[model samples]
Each structure stands twice: as structure tokens, then as C-alpha cells.
Target chain A: MRADMIPLAFRDPVHDSQSAFRRLLRALSRPGTPVSLPGPAEAPEPMGGPLAAIALTLADADCPIWLDPALSTERVRRYLHFHTNAPQLADPRAAAIALIGDAGWLPGLNGFHPGDAPYPDRSTTLILQLPALTGGSTVRLSGPGIETTTSLAPLGLPNWFWPAWHENAARYPLGVDIFLTDDRAVVGLPRSTNVEVP
Target chain B: MGIDLAFDDHGVYSFAYLDEMTKRMIRRAILKAVAVPGYQVPFGSREMPLPPGWGTGGLQVTASLLGREDMLKVIDQGADDTTNAISIRRFFARVAGVATTERTGEATVIQTRHRIPERALTEDQIIVFQQPQPEPLRRFIPHEVVARKLHAFAQYGVMYVRLYEDISRLGHVAMSSDYPVIVNGRYLASPSPIPKFDNPKLHRSRALALFGAGRERRIHAIPPFTDVKSLDFVDHPFTVQHFESCCSLCGAQDSYLDEILLDDGGRRAFVCSDTAYCAEQRGERTKS
Candidate 1:
């Protein structure tokens, strides 16, 4: 931690961003379970509380972060660009990292590359901030990382997300990975993780 | 309600960038590479802030695929201590917060420019090459159109013509830097800009081969047994260069020699091309 160059407008919340990030990985490798982050940050601009956490957790110069029209602002752009060198792209497909906290404008999750059968992991990871995401949904999650069963709040993806993702998983090797971030948490849904979605 | 005096100040070092999504992209590429084994996939490349020819491409692959518990090795011109090598090694240590190592055997992901390590790699290891141009036909003719056709149909006649031209005109292939090779019979690719001395090392390796060109926006892979063929005329055949000198730093014979200039008298100093390789070999001899 470089104590000298702390940005004045940055989030000083005492949450372990790194630990949350580590948890993000486990969630990604394991799928569907919620992992909490410090979050609830004052996201640069246009973005809300939950979105702030996603940007703080994933933004970097190396990754391409596509900010939707629903959450665009000069302050947000400058902050992300200055901090993480993460270039903002016009198209979501070109993005290495896609940040969509607004449930309404988020693209159909299946529109991005799901991956190829031989190389099924080529899909884009959609980081979606769910609408009131708290557990108690009947969705049964099972797959590569999950042993028996798990459940969580309805991941606020597009209505078309499940059908598209099911087709995606059927292809195997080629598929997208997903991260569902709620108030202060995030979880993964890799293609390998089978979803009953009942 | 309590009055608050604190203002928001974002501190340094946020969570890592290569998120599960991005990591999934690279991992999927790797899994496909494992499945078909050696076919290269043309992926949509992201624009990293760094310029091309820099280690940005390799860094992307390294960042995306690295797990929390992985040791990374970065090498340039075969030496792990080269300034560029050090820069990349430090990059991962800072960003991904992963471990770095000079020892080849300990590293799970070895990001390299030019030559592969003198020590053999294992199945667990992956070598990512920083490629300036991923297309094999760049040298023969700079036409992407024709090159694409050549690669699409496995028509590598032009490469042979160039090699035969070298053998006939100079008695040896006079090309060095970004040598072309046929990977998996169908795809002809460049092995980054490594000198031709490292060409033979690509044969029958246990480790995976991934090539990325950030400027060109492409990523591809070569799996084991993929049959990487360096374009050669049957008559002239393929050849690798060897320096007939010992390393002054760690005196070992039969190693790739990097030319260094000594005093004003114009004397030359020859040392191991692989810096860590030289140190390891010498350390072994001293211990024995």
C-alpha cells in the first residue's frame, strides 16, 4: 500500500478488498454462493452503492471495463481510468471486464461469447448487481465445483439469461462465466457449474 | 446522530483486475488448447494501457489465468534478471499479489520473451510468449490476406521459398527474431521474437504454449505433440545456432552465448544467454 498517493475521493472503507477479491475467486471456481466484500462504496458517479464495490474489486488498467449508459459519468470514468488503467470500451464483447449494476439496461447475458466446445471457456463474465439479492430462492445449483446442492437469491440477470446459459452449457468447453454482486457480496457461476434453475 | 469529520480517500491497491470473467476467457482458451491439444484460437484481444512489443500481452495471459497459489517466472532473452524480465516479474507481484521465482522448476506459469528456459518444463507448467506478430507469413510477405490463405490451407510453400533463398544466398537461413513454425499441422505461427537458437526447444514439450499480441489483439495456443514445424526446405533443412564460448559469469560450456563488450580495447565478453540457467548450472557444478 503506497501511503503517499492516496486519492482524496477514494473509498476508505476498512474492508479487506483483497480478501473480498480472493473470495470472488472461490465463488467463481465454486459458483452461485454469495461472498461479501467491503463495498457499499461511493461509486465514482452515476453508479450506485453495489456497483461501487464491483468497480473497486475488479477495475484495473489491464481489464476493459464497459460502463453502461445507465451508469456513465466523468467522475466515474476518470476515477477508474486513473486508478486501474482499465480502458472503457464502446462494445461489451471487446471488454475483458464488463460492469453492469443497472438491471434494466444490462444486455442479454447470452449475447456475449459463451466459448467454443473445444475451448468452452471463452465467454464474457457479466458482473451484475442484483435487485435486492438476499437468499431464499428455490434455484438448485450443481456442477464442477459444487458437490451436492446450493441455493441463493435469484441472480438478477436478464430474463433470457437462463435459457441462453443452458444452451451455452450444453456446448461445454465454450461458455461464459458470471459474477453476481449484491449489496456487499459477489459470487461466481462458471459454465462448468451446472444449474437446475428450478 | 454523530457528526463525521472523515472524507473519502481511495487507498492504493484494489482487488486484482483479471476477474472471474476475464480469467474464464483465458481458462477456456487453455482448456480448448488441452482438448484439441494444439490448435490456436483467435480471441478478441483487449487493449491494455501499455504499448505493443512490451510484455503487456504475456502479462494479460499471466494475470487472467493465475490462481492465488501460483508461482510465476518471467524471462527476457532467456535471462530472468533482464530489466524487462524484472519489470514483468514485479508486475504480477504487485497486481495479482502472486509469488515470483527465478528457479524454473518452481514456477507454475513461466512468461517468457524469446528463448525457453534451458531446463525442461513439466506438464503443470505453462509458457506464455509475448508475440509481436502471431502470423507466420509476416516475413515471407506482409500480406495478411495471403498469409491467412496459407494458414487456412496449410500452404506453406512461400516459407520454403524464403528458406531456400536464405540457404542459397547466404549458405544458411539469415533470419533471426520471430522465427515461424508450423503448429498442429494446420496453423503456422511465430514463436515470438526469440532468436532462432531456441527454435528446436519447442519440440515435444510437456508445457503449454500460448501466444498473445496486444497490439494485434490476438491470442492463440499450441498444445503438446502439436507438431511445430520450422519452415525449412528438405534440401537445406532446419538449423539452430550455438556459440563456441563459456560463460564468464558462471563458466559453463555449450550454452547460448550473449555477446557483451569489455574495455575500450574492443575485447568481447561472452556469457550465458539464459541468466538463471547459467547461475543454476554453475551452482550445480560448484555443489558437486
Candidate 2:
């Protein structure tokens, strides 16, 4: 009962996790589509609700996760470790799942796994913490998910992130997929999404 | 003696007959499959209670994606009443406790073997296909390692040669079902033995199409509004099968028909392969 009050993890692990995974799945399938995430993960400072919810839902013993140094506080590490039991990797490239704690200090795409041509799926999925999902510069996206083109304004990303993402998309079957999460919402930007600034 | 109801109880097996971790793994693979849009993503295919060849891949995918609210549908060669479809549908009904439907329009997730439904699917709907063989280059390159390399380099010369040979020998490409389609103009994928007639449904489809090969241990996906091109040369363009006469039962000239032998002698009759679609058409006809 005390544990329930703390709310460090999902209240109903089975159902909550399933719901979260399904949301993540839908978001990934339809790129640039924002899906409301499950809340109340009792997240640490700077690690918003949605990312914490995602961490609890997807990460496990098998998938090694990497947290950006800025957000790698002892409390955040403890919370993730106690909840997910996923190994934390120091090197971003080695990580299957990478978390961008501060969008201002975003890393280059080369550091992470741009998986080989044959096994492009081996690349990492970046879970970036953004300021807000709406009200940012609208980036036009078109690809498998979008019927023609869709616009999403995800705030708190670096200026060069869009160009880097375009370069990443040019790689096609070899770029990393991403999840942009704010305090509440999460949107997926798959490698297949064709991003344009205008 | 009363049949032991204990085995049929809710807690006897995990929800949907698969552990959460396994489902998560499959889910991750599905995400990757959708992202790449038709590239084969290798997954740790788990053994189901059913036989290996019997829709295990589709079952695993369905089990992973399925939720309590999802309305499910299962079909084999477009028929909702086949043993394969019925067994799968019933399995989900028992384990997942989700609603099952025969009508294509009502289903949120339609797991199928060798056929896409006759009706057009909505954007929200997802189709999971039971793929016996996910790779299209296997016919030319038997070795898996070599085939992987060939796909990596985009060295599809052998596939073109094979098609060239078919045109030279047979007048036209002889492949009826399981036709190879270059997905998003990238990887060559098997369309799960669905007839060439249904291949057009795959191109820029409104619904998401997922292919699972349990035995082969591969999963692929074609996301909604994606381009899927069937392989054909300029001289011999891809063409679908058409019947001379309409369906003998429902008179559906446009629908894919199943030819049944009336007798050992030469009499044959054609009817709609999709039982539910045929029934729905009949119901509409009677209503009018």
C-alpha cells in the first residue's frame, strides 16, 4: 500500500504497460503523430512524466539504456534502475535506447548506431525530452505514416537538429528513430519521415 | 465426467498466451518493421501451442498488438470460417477476451493467411499476414547469408533474371499468389501468398499491413499510405487474374472468386472466396 502511494512505477503494470506500448507503437507507425502518454510515474527532476512512463514500459534487463550526462542524476538513475532493471550504458552508441535529458545539448547522429544496411533495425531509438510538443517551429513531414504531409511543432530542440534529422533521414534504412516527449505528450519521428523546414 | 474447467480458466495461461517480455520484444520488432516499411526485421519467434506452419507468426503479432478493446478478425485465404481462421479467432477470444467479428469493416485488427479482405480497410485498421516465407530473393539465392548480402547491396539482378526466364518459358510471369513486390522501392518482400488480384490493395493502402513468418523468424510491415510496387518488366507488366464469368453463387464479377469442381467430370463453378463478403453482398441484395 505504501508502494502504491509512492507511485514510482505503473499502478497496474500489465494493463498500463500494454497501453503505453500500444501508444508508442501507434506513434512510431504514424510518424509525427502525437499521442497522449500515460502519466503519474513519480519521475525525478528534469525527467518528465511521459519519458518516465516510456522507460518503465519499454526498457527491461535485455535493453541497455543510455541517459544523457546532464540528466544522469543519482536519484533519476536509482528510480530507472529500481523500476526497469535495465542496464545503463555509458556510451551512447552502445545503448539500444538513448535518452536525451537536455535538448539544448543534443549529440550528433554519428555517435549513435546508424545500423548497417542489412540490419537497420539494430539502431537506437532516442527518447528526447522537449519543452513542449506544440508551439514550436512547424516541421513538415511526409512518408509512410503521413497521408501527404503533416506538421508538428516540437519546442526545445537545438537549431541544427532539423538539418541533422534530414541528413539522418537521407540515410534511409540506417538512421535512428526518435520519440519527442514533453511533460505530458509524446510524438514519434521515425527514420522514414521526410522532414522539411518550410 | 465433467471436463476439467481449470485449464480453461483465466489465470491458467498468461493473457493472450504469451509473457509480457515476449510481447514487448515482438512489439519492438513491429515498430521497427513499421519504421522501415517492408524491410524484414528478425525476431525471436516463440513457439505457440499450434504447429509451426499454422499462423504462428501472425498469432504472435496479433497477440502482441491485441488489447481488450480491440475488435479482432481472423481469416484464411479470405474465408472467415476456415479451420485456421476459426482456431485463431477462438484462441484470441479465449485468451485475450476480446470481441471477434467476421465482417471486415468492423475489425480493428485483421489477422489473415494468404488473402487481404475484399473490402477496403480504414486507416486505423491493421492487417497481420501469416507469411510462410518473408524473403522474395530466396528463390534465386537459396543461402540465407548470400541472400542477406544481396539485399544489403541491392543486388537484385538475379531476381530480374528469374523473372526474365519466367517470361521466356511461360508467356507471362507464372507466379499467381505469393507474388513478390518491391516495397517502398526498397526491399523485395513476399505478399503472403495473396493472389495477384489483391496485390493492388497493398499499394498505398489506407491500413497498416504486417507480415509475420514464424518458421522463417522474420517480421515485415507496410505502413499506411506507403508505395508498394509489384515487380514487372516494361515488356511484361504486372497483370491480375480475371474470370470470364461472374460468381455462380453471389454474381460478384469484381470480387476474387474460388473455383470449385462440381464433379469428377469437367463441370466447374466459381464462387466468392470471402464468405463474409459474399454473405454481406447477398444480405444487401436481399435488402434492395
Residue B84 lDDT in candidate 1: 86
Docking class of 2: medium
**Interface RMSD computed for candidate 2 is what?**
1.1
User: What is the C-alpha lDDT profile of model 2 across B1-288, one tens digit per residue?
Assistant: 986777665567778889988887888888889889878999999999899899999999999888888999998988988899989998998888888999888899999998888889998899999999999988777998899888787788887888898899988898898888888877888898899999999999989899999999999999988899999999899999989988887788889999899998979999999877888888752111
Mark the regions of model 1 whose C-alpha exceeds 4 Å error after superposition: A1-198, B1-15, B33-40, B140-145, B284-288
Give the residue spans of candidate 2 off by over 4 A.
A1-7, B1-5, B284-288
Clashing pairs in 2: B178-B193
| Top lDDT model | 2
Deviation of model 2 at A85, angstroms: 1.3
Q: How many backbone clashes does candidate 1 have?
A: 15
Per-residue lDDT of model 1, residues A94-196, tens digit only: 7756777576785566556564433333446677767655643556776544445777556455576677767766655456666776666667776555567
Relative to the unseen true structure, what is the C-alpha lDDT of residue B89 in candidate 2, on a scale of 0 to 100? 92
Worst 10 residues of 1 chain B by lDDT: B7-16
- Candidate 2: global Cα-lDDT? 0.87
